[model samples]
Target: MAIVNATDQTFVTETSTGVTLVDFWAPWCGPCRMIAPVLEEVDQEMGDKVKIVKVNVDENQETASKYGVMSIPTLLVFKDGNVVDKTVGFQPKEALVQLLQQHV
Candidate 1:
């Protein structure tokens, strides 16, 4: 499945079911840019096992703050609406796949 763009208004419902990876990032963040392609590959390869969602920190501050996302490119893995794992900064594709593998 394609990655879904989420906002503060819809973040909860978007991540309420199944395994989800929520990327909290901003356009100005270089690390966030670096991780974009990795996320895309993950979505392509493991779309059936997990759902990916992105929230722009610039436009969705409430959701970011609610999750205590202190930095850009903060990746949170949610299972059935609760956060299960989290990582910060740019992560290699291998690492990303491994991260999602745990929850799937």
Candidate 2:
């Protein structure tokens, strides 16, 4: 599936199943900007194997706070409504795929 822009209201429902990578970021964060394209490549390569979503920390603080996302470009991997793993900062596509491979 395509990358989804998840809101606080939709986060729970959207990331409730399978392997999901929720990127907690803001538009002005440099690292977040740097990681956006990498996530795109990962989304395309992984396809239905994973669900990729973006949660703008500036816009969705509740969700970000709930996840304890103190930094931008924080990536949370969720399975069945629980966070299985999390990574922070910018990472290359290969590294992201490897991260997903651990949970998927």
Score each candidate by Cα lDDT.
0.94, 0.93
Q: How far is candidate 1 from the true structure (C-alpha RMSD, Å)?
A: 0.6
Give lDDT tens digits, candidate 1, residues 38-96. Answer: 99999999999899999999999899999999988999999999999999999998998
Q: Show pairs that collide, candidate 1.
A: none
Over 5-85, each residue of candidate 2 has an lDDT whose tens digit, in order, gives 999999999999899999999999999999999999999899679999999999999999998999888999999889999
TM-score of 2: 0.98
The regions of model 2 sitting more than 4 angstroms off are none
| Clashes within 3 Å, all models in order | 0, 0
Clashes (candidate 2): 0
TM-score of each: 0.98, 0.98
